[model samples]
Every structure is written in structure tokens, then in C-alpha cells.
Target: MRLSVVDTELCVGCQCCMFACARRSGLGGIASSAITVRSMGGMEKGFKVIVCRACDDPPCARACPTGALTPKPGGGVRLNASKCIGCGRCAQACVLGAVQWDDDVNKPSICIQCGYCVSFCPHGVLAMEDK
Candidate 1:
């Protein structure tokens, strides 16, 4: 399954999805979340929900020098933390900027397409769908 943005217009910038994503990793803050919510400028301009698009051939995976990231079956990538060198290349390679950084561990916190954040979207702005 892949997480999708169902409707950006519905987003209120509450960042509940971000919080839920972080919670799934047993973290207490948005710093670890794979998903992000940002204002366009102000509340009236709506919000942008940033998350992995599950690219078929992800550039981030291609940029992993240590073979730490491998492509998932459907889309996106699976990160092997043990092999990661924390080079930050994956984050830079991702055009969507979906590869989030974890300053504490110095590793990328990528979405596993687990859909944990979907349920927390009060505005129905997110969804999980089969590939």
C-alpha cells in the first residue's frame, strides 16, 4: 500500500497526520515524522501535505552509496539503518523532499507506506491505496 494525498484543499495545517506518523515510530514529536504539513503562506491559502509519492524508480534509492536503501515491492524504499552511512544523499536526491531527516540518529526517516497517519487526518486529506 501507498499513502496518498486525497485532497490538499481539505488540509487545515493542523499537522495531526505529522504527529501520527511520528507516534508510529514511538516518537513524541514531529521531528521523526515522514509526513509533513505546511502552510502555503497563511491559513487562508490552504496547506500542503508533503509525503512520499512512492516513485516507481526512486532517485533516493539510486543515490544511496552504501546500499542502505532498497526499492519496495510496489514503490518507495525500505531503509536498512545498519547499513546507512547517514550521508544525507537520499534526502537531497528526493525531488519531493519526502525523505525526512532524524537529527537524533543522523538517519533519514522515510515513510514505510504503513498508512498509520491516514487515520489521524480529520479532514480526509490522506488515504492509503493499493499499488
Candidate 2:
């Protein structure tokens, strides 16, 4: 399963989803989040939610020289932190620009599509669905 953008038009740009993602990692800020919300251009243009689509064949996994990245059953990839050398290869392989970086740890914060952020979204802008 993966997250789907239900409706971008309804987004109010509150960034609750971003905070929720950070909270999932037990972090106080968005630094470790796998999701991001940003303005398309300005506040009036609404926000763009940047998240992993859980690709069927994740490029990030293939780019892992240490085999740190492994694809999930439905979509996306899971990082084996033990194997990750903070190489940042997986982040570079992400074509959709969904792989968020953890500069302190030198790893990409890829989404597992657990829908934690979706629950926090005030507007119905995001949803968890079968691929």
C-alpha cells in the first residue's frame, strides 16, 4: 500500500502532515520526516505535498551499493540502517524527489506509507490506498 493525494485543491497549507511525519520518528521537528508540504509558488497558489509514491520497482533500492535499501511488497523501500553508510545514493535515485535526507545521519527518510501523516491532515488531501 501507498499514500495517494486525494485532493490538492482542499489543502490549506497548514503543514500538519509534515509535523506528523516527524512525530512518527519521535522527532521534535521536520528534520526526520519522509513527507513535505511547500507552497507551489506563493501562499495563494496552494501547497504541494511531496511524498513517496511507493514505486513498484524503486530506483533507490537499486542504487544502494551496500544493499541498504530494499523494496517493500507493494511499494516503496525500507532502509536497513545497519547497512546504510550514509552514502546518499538512494536519495539521488529518487526521481520524484520524495527521498528526504537526514543530514545528521546521512540517510534518506523514505516513507513507508503507514498513513500516520494522513491521519493528521485536517483537510482530506491525503489517503492510504492499495496500489
Candidate 3:
């Protein structure tokens, strides 16, 4: 499965999806979320929803020096935190800026495509579909 942005125009910058993503990991705030919602300059310009696009050939995985990131079956990558050296190369490699940083663990927080956040998006901005 993959999490898709159905319509960015429907997004209201509510950040409900981000909260839900973080909550899936038993976190209390957006800092741990794999998804992010940010203003496009200001509220009038709408918002940008940043999440892994599940690239067929992910550059982030290729940028990992320690082999901590391996490509997932469908797309994206699976992170092995124990092998991660906190190099932050993965974040820099993501062209979409989808790879989120976890300051607490000093690791990347990647979307597993579990679709936990889709249900929380009140504006129908997100969806889960088969790859």
C-alpha cells in the first residue's frame, strides 16, 4: 500500500494527518511524524504536505553510507536505526524533503505506508492505494 496525496487544494493546513502519523508511534506531537504540513509562504497560498512519494528508485537509500536504509518491496525504504550513524545524508538526498528528522533519536522518520494518517484527514486530502 501507498499513502497518496489526493488533493493538496483540499488541505487546510490543519495538520491532522501529521498528528495522526505521530500518534501511530505513540508520540504526542508533530516532531515525530513522517508526514508534515507547512504553509506555502502564508495561509493565503495554502499548504504543502510533505511525505514520502515511495520512489521506485529512492536516492535517500542510495545516500546511506552505513547500509542502514534498504529499499522496500514496493517503494521507499526501511530504516535500521541501530545501523544508522546519524549522518543525516538520507535527509539531504530526498529531493522532496519528505525524509523527516527525529531529533530525539537522531534518526530519520520514514513513512511505512501504513495509511494510519489518511483517516484523520478531514478534508479528504490523503488516500491509501495499492502500488
Candidate 4:
């Protein structure tokens, strides 16, 4: 599947994606959501959409000593928290800054491509396309 961003100009800087990403654990919590979008300088200029681009070669997966990060069937990274050692190396390895830190849990929050956040997005900015 291809991760597509359409009509990004319509984004409201609401950070609904961030909160949705945090809701992937199916518990309506931000403890495990992995995406984040924030303002570049100010909200007036628009928001910066930050999410895993389903990289062909993901550095975060490579940096995980415990192999917690793995390749998803569609083309994104899947995080196995049980295997993770709470190391921040994967977060540092992600160039897109898609990997978020769970301050409360002291672990990396990686996207699972569940599209839960996409459903919560009020604006039609994020979409999952079968490429």
C-alpha cells in the first residue's frame, strides 16, 4: 500500500493524526500511536505532517538491536514492544522523525499502519492507497 497525503493544504494543524496515531493500540489512548504532525514555525504557515513513509530501507529497523522493528507486509515498520529494550536508537535512526518517544513508558512509538488515525482525521489529508 502507498501512504498518500492529499489536499494537505486543507490541514488545520489540529494534530488529529498525532492523537489518532497514539490511538492504534485499540484502547483509545496515545500511549502507542506512532505518528506526529506539528507546526514548522507557526500554525499560520500550516502544519508539518510527520509519519513513516513506508521506506524501502528503514534505518529504525536496522538500529533495533532487539529486532523489535520489522517490515510490515504493506511497506511500513511494525514495532514489537515485547522485543524492544526501551532503547532510543530507533527513534534517533528515523530521519523523518516518524518514531516518537513514549515519555511515560520510556520506549519508541512506531506506526503500525492501522489507519485508525486516518479515520479520525477531520480533513481529507491522509489516505492509505494500494500501490
Candidate 5:
């Protein structure tokens, strides 16, 4: 089970992981990435990194009228471009705020837990752990 885990105490707010995620989409920009790193509030609070939890029962899928969001082989939902209507329902259904979006394309960008971002975390904040 290769899952993305966060060691928040080790996080240095470098955002290297986030950049790697964007690059995984071959878009060379954060807009295409599924992960998000933002200040929890301010510098004193460090940052809050958001990624899909790979829920056993994903709410985003239940909210999709077109069934565009469906469960992956392991966890999380895979985006079926052909079935998607760009309604933004998946983004709104996520309780963790992990169901990110591509503003230009109007689609949900949930993490596949691929671990690409883990490699870029110089501070050992992100890891691909076998659970």
C-alpha cells in the first residue's frame, strides 16, 4: 500500500513536494497538480499540506452526476474525462478540501497517491509508507 504520509513536524514549508506534484501532470504548473500546500494561517503556524485521503467510500463519487469520479484500484477516485461534465461537484463534496481543481479545465484533481511528491520533499516531511 503505497500511500502518501505527512510528517508535519518535519515540514519546513519548502513546497518542493507541491511543485513535484504539478510536474507529474506534465503541465509544469501548480494548477494541474492534485496536492496543495498553504499556510495553516501564518508563518507561525507553518503550512497545511492537503492531499486525498483515499477514502473507502468517497463522497466525491456519490456527488458526481456523470460518475466521472470513481474509485481507483487501491483508493481515491480516478477522473474519467469522457464522463466528466465539469460541474465542480467533486470539489464541493470533499470534506478534507483535498479534492482540488484545475481552474482552466474545470475538473477535479484528486491525488492518486502516486508518491511523486514524496521524492521532492527534502525535509522528510512527505513519505510513501506501506500501510
Candidate 6:
């Protein structure tokens, strides 16, 4: 699949992408989204959109000791919390900084390629395409 994002130079530095990404968890709050946008300085320089690049060979999956970060046959990695050991190896292995650490739950927060966050983005910053 060809995954891409719609980067607009006209971003308003509003962290709607962050809140949108957090909404992908199906929770009422914004804790599960993989994307985040933060102010550069005082919102004058604008915000930075941070999210997973959906790598071809995800290094995070290789660092999981419990097989919690297994790659799906279709694409992307499938995180199994039951098999997770809470080790930060996956986080360290991820060069793109996509694998996040959930300190509250003591687990790694990984993106499963679910496109829920794309809908919440008013700026159209994220998308999942089929190759």
C-alpha cells in the first residue's frame, strides 16, 4: 500500500492532529493517536506534524521480545498487548520515533495503520493508500 500525508504549508499550528491521533484509540480522550503537532516556539513559526511514516521494514517489530509487535500480512505491525512485556526495546529500535511509550500503562504505543485519526484532521494531514 502507498501511505501518504497531506502536508499543507498553511497549517494553523493547532494541535488538532495530536488530538485526532489520540482519538484513534476509540476512547473518549486523545491518548491513542500516533500523530502530534506542537508549536515551534510561540505558534508564530507554526507547529510540527509528527506521526508514523509506516516504514517498509519496521525495526520496532524486530525489538519486541514478546512478539507483541508482529507485522501483519497485509501491511503494518499488529501490537498484541497480551504478549507485550513493557520493554522499551521497540521504542529504541524505531528510528522514525513512531513507537511511543505509554507511561501510564507501562507499554509501547504503536500505530496499527488504522485510519481513524485521518477523519478528525480538519487539515487533511494523514491518509492510508492502497498500493
* Candidate 6 lDDT score relative to the true structure: 0.69
Residues 8-127, model 4: lDDT tens digits: 688898877777776565566566667777787888888778777787778888898998888776577888878988989998998888888988788887766667677878988899
Better of 3 and 5 by TM-score: 3
lDDT of 2 by residue, 1-131 (tens): 78989888899998899899989868787888898888889989988888899998989899999988899887789888899898887888887778899776777887888999999999899999888
Please report, as a residue range, the 10-residue window in candidate 4 with the lowest summed lDDT: 23-32
Q: Roughly what TM-score does model 4 have, to 2 decimal places?
A: 0.86
lDDT of 5 by residue, 2-109 (tens): 556566767778878877988886767688778887887886887787778787778998899998888876667888888988898888889778888888788877
Off by over 4 Å in 5: none
| Candidate 6 lDDT, 45-131, residue by residue in tens | 776665666665678887788888887676567789888888899889876566767766788777666676667667766666873
Number of clashing residue pairs, candidate 3? 0
lDDT of 2 at 33: 86
Residue-pair clashes, model 5: 0
Ranking by lDDT: 3, 1, 2, 5, 4, 6
Off by over 4 Å in 3: none
Q: lDDT per residue, candidate 1, 6-109, as tens digits?
A: 89999888899889988986868877888888888887999878899899999999999999999988789999999999999999999888999988899999
Question: How many collisions per candidate?
Answer: 0, 0, 0, 2, 0, 3
Rank candidates, TM-score, best first.
3, 1, 2, 5, 4, 6
lDDT (Cα, tens digit) per residue for candidate 3, span 1-131: 88889889999999999899889878698778999999899989988998898988899999999999999988989999899999999999998899999898889998899998999999899999888
For candidate 2, the lDDT comes to 0.87
TM-score of 1: 0.94
Overall lDDT per candidate, in order of appearance: 0.91, 0.87, 0.91, 0.78, 0.80, 0.69
Give Cα distance to truth, residue 14, candidate 6, Å: 2.4
